[model samples]
Target: MRNKSIKKLNNKMNSKKVIVTFLILVCTIFNIGAQNITPDSKVLYKKVNGDSLYLHLFKPEISKKPTAAIVFFFGGGWVGGNPKQFYQQSKYFASRGILAISAEYRVKNTHGTSPFECVEDGKSAIRWVRENAKELNIDPNKIVASGGSAGGHVALTTALIKGLENVDENLSVSSVPNAVVAYNPVSDTTLKGYGSKKVVGRETEISPTDQVKKDMPPMLIFHGTKDKTVPFENAERFTRLMKEAGNDCELVAVDNMGHGFFNGDFFRKGTGNKYFNLTAYKTDVFLEKLCYLKEKPTLAENIKQVSCIGDSNTEATYPKFLQEKLGENYQVKNFGKGGATLIEGTNHPYFKKKEYKNSLKFTPDIVLIMFGTNDANVKWCLDKTRKTKFIGTPQEEFKSQYIKLINTYKRKNENAEIYVLTPLPIYEHAKSRDPEIKKRIKHLYDWVIPIIREIAEEQNVKLIDVNKLMKKAYKYTVDGIHLNQKGYKILAKKIAKEIK
Candidate 1:
């Protein structure tokens, strides 16, 4: 009888010890003051391997409805990297009405963890987001995963390679994201690939390229052909396999760009990272295509901002002339990008450039839009002809995008005056620098110019005919497409007089 009593006493004491230990661990691992934590912060999200993982969030300024979300992981070959790698990205996506998060994971240098732990943490972060979606005001089904290099591999793995999830995480909620966007990811961790060394024995298990399956979510990849670190071929191989498995994957091969090409350059140099801004814009396009965003962006703060929007011609020469004439009080700034077509979905859409966003941010009293030069380039688009770099056609995309761009400015300032300019006549000749421009000069006048006129008439806005003004001034063209300084001066003088 005494022995039975002792056994019961021992069992009860052991149960109490276990409960006390569990309580101590809970106290150490979980943030007791979680309510005091910021809305999107270094949240002690995942508890594993006796460590806590954090993720920072950038939520929409006004969350009127449940919104889509994107989570970013930073890359450092599993040795290092932090959440801040995508800080600018998160902020940009947030401004566009999506919940953006930059997640922290176990890295080799910091956590003495393997790639397996990284994957586990990555999965946990996604699971956490879904688990708390109602409170975060996020639509659980519209989550997207994106990252650069190794971080990209982690994001990709969340969709492709599975089963490395943390045991404590809720498995009922999917770790898989609805869409994936990778920037020069170390996607293939096979023995033949660069990242294979990091995972060592478990390369095949974590390799996204090896795990391609049907019914996978849509994916967008921007990999530089010149990327020597991960080899542009890795992304191509993964994309090829993904397609073969009947998955929707779009690979944007960036020519002559190296690894980490999407990183913002502000910290390195004072100038904004054009590459970062462009990629972020492209991501926005991708999400919009999926109908995932809560709403389109609108309005901003400003001064006596005069935003000059256009293609390469407007980039430096003519905008400089306009700026010089306007003087300091007008604050005329050129937000033009080379090879920019106003049509959306093209490789070089004006909407994809940082200049476009900056122009809107300028909150100008007067807006000058000088496009149609690139839009008229015959080889660019002809209803999915597969010959051009642009994804939009002049007929379907030009007029609508023009109206949208105009409305975007008006939203910023209802009183803002906008003027549309017709492109100069293409002078194809021996001196023309661009062969395509010379060869396809006919399209500009035949179709693009007439369309610009139609939009100017229908939209009931001010029209400035730079082309008709210089129809006989072909000799002033530096290229068949772009104008020389003398031609720009004529344009500037004309614009200055009209606006005045």
Candidate 2:
């Protein structure tokens, strides 16, 4: 069950990245094609370690560069794992204006005297980043190492362990990271750790927390409540020891979550797990604390205040955008119901049926609407041909039902502005939908735009032409329908621009 939850979290995180990145990459490619480049850029830096170890670096293109850097190591039990495990880490940090490097280390199978080789590689990557801090426009003093599972062990060890004499022959640089951010790291090198004896040779010398020093860097650890693989108590014990030794350390145990909570089901495909993706939430907290940035996020405080209303697009839209844009100003309420249409009345199957009840209660200053996407689908009866038989026709009835929903908002808060957004284009070759369906989605602009315009005119509210905005930022969409990071960013900017 724990594994299932972690897998779910991994998938959840992956789904977010795939959607966001596709949108951003699409826009980036189009921009580059047009000699227009975005502020975000990534480059692959290869360092020779007998063979080349590829390090993927994500950085903003802005002139005043990052004040910190995060070097991430991946986990696959030390024998088989890739750098991509930190996909969300790289993107999350980069989105926050931190230079994030996802470093690939030599796995045990192909290259290494022991897991220590992985540590050496991790250390070298950190040193390389610091050595090139000036060129990379990073602050060397702010470099940190972060990872999960075996990767976490590597991060913690590289930070706490004093010498790398075994792998020193392979590198000419320091093996220390300024700070350590470990997610469920193996602090004790006993038989209890997954394959600990095989890697570290049954020695107490390998335990990281057991060797704390006054010079030890500040550390943050995130673990899950039900994490059986690396028991939550292990992390607690490690944190306790760190504090006992007068070293700076903190531990967060996510409620009802399990090991590898950084990712949700999106990463693991269809693994049927429900882990909370604690990494996604905790990572933001980690970085905020690391930089000593004043706007520290408190989950207990924010969860109660923020709500969101969206569709699948909401996953990419409100949560991904508004959370970052507004920061801590307004609590986000997510009402984004996937595959929901306005016309279904109280019995509407998806989120609409449940969300419509509280719509009046929230009485938010600004109500964001991105309802047209799923409504454009044949399933929701918004398709130009063959609308869902139960939901009525696509264009007119759909528009009327949406208007009625909006009117309720006006009744509740006369001063609140309803932002109407047009649906983004669909992918040209989506397997889920038939060719006709795909074509209908691609032509969403033809039908939905006019209806949205009419609604905006009649209501006297703002209309964010996301479809038009997204058209200019095309590369971010996978098949011209689902958005990637670039697309979400464009939409986010449009929404943020209208607000203040």
Candidate 3:
């Protein structure tokens, strides 16, 4: 009896320990994911037949007038994919002062709806947004619809096809959007093009391009030359037809790129963009065109467009000073965000946010790059957690991606000249992160400086060792992290001297 009692007590103790350990793990996970919760978004629904259709509407943050809205549809080949895939893009648009609505329609698997029914529902969503524009603080006249793949098909079809009398009468409004931005879309549904397979009788109705006519709103089409699913020529043909109809149209061909080019290169890196062959692709130049479509400058226009491309230092350090030095020419177009490596820029976040814009409006005649800092940091994790593939060891991958970035810029802009600046030295001041961080910085310089020399020798591109030059102007820097106005003046002058 005594031995049995002791065994039960020990078992109880182990159970308690297990519970405590599980609690600790749960707390740790919660801590890692503890971001500020965004306010609950407003959800609105419309009853269709006996069921209900839902739309997630994110109103503009600050606007005097009803903002231009987008009834966004997510891509799933008409059978699958979820509406939640648009969370980031929707929030981004809403944060940028645009009203965004991510709409949900019956999917083929879920509702057994035909492709035609999906298109009809897409049209109905646009009509709903327009009908309730005033109530939703949206501009009916300026509503724009956008999507990718099948979603792109929906956006383009709605904009290109004029009269959809079958659209829900209860909504009671025109389905036409003022603008359509289709990302790697099925421009010709007839499936008779370079990349399309015959799907006329099998899946979808006849090609929407066949139904094209005049009065379609301005269309912006983006496609990858290497896209096997959707032909690049389809985009070209659609743009041609729209132009022939006297409607405004523009197509941005992403060189060495492929299908679903939207987030593949722009949203996140290593998100299956390896097939894109983006080693020399200029994606941002195209995106900026969409943003500044009405305000695009002519080729002869000499606008002071400066690009500050680098890692964290570019974002946290040089931009504000560069802005002051150039006065008006400084647009603070820094391509680097935090923890971003060179590969990320060439393939993703930077390409989407910065480079896509440059493709459309103005290629930077002058680019200032200061990136080796992160590349050299040995403690840095080369592989992103979500992206299991190793981007590469610091030396091999960093050097290759940087070379690719320069080559890409050259390919995009014939007159483009990149001024590669070595990263600044780590400051002597630090509490805990000083010694190891500084050591890594030195390691980066060892790898990067020699590579820069080799690059200068091989290519016509210019290299500036800001580390050595800044030593002469050390007093101009703030915390040795960034440049003050005096430092920027000196840095710009040094760059100008190098260029001259």
Using lDDT as the measure, name the better of candidate 1 and candidate 3.
1
Question: All candidates' TM-scores?
Answer: 0.54, 0.52, 0.54
In model 2, the runs with Cα more than 4 Å from the true position are 1-49, 165-173, 200-202, 264-266, 270-278, 292-500
Tell me the tens digit of each residue's lDDT in model 1 across 136-183. Answer: 668999999999998998889899876987676668988999999999
Q: Any idea how many clashes model 2 has?
A: 51
lDDT of 3 by residue, 130-188 (tens): 87665565678877777777787888877866554353465356887878877777777
lDDT string for model 2 (394-467, tens) is: 57776876787777777865666677877765656443444466646653666767888888898887787777
* lDDT sort, best first: 1, 2, 3
The residue ranges of model 3 lying beyond 4 angstroms of the native Cα positions read 1-40, 47-53, 61-68, 80-98, 108-114, 139-142, 160-172, 193-206, 214-218, 224-226, 243-257, 262-266, 269-455, 472-500
TM value for model 2? 0.52
Go through the candidates in order and give the C-alpha RMSD of each one to the true structure: 19.2, 14.4, 15.9
Candidate 1 matches the true fold with a TM-score of 0.54
lDDT-wise, the better of 1 and 2 is: 1
Model 2 misses residue 399 by how many Å?
Answer: 34
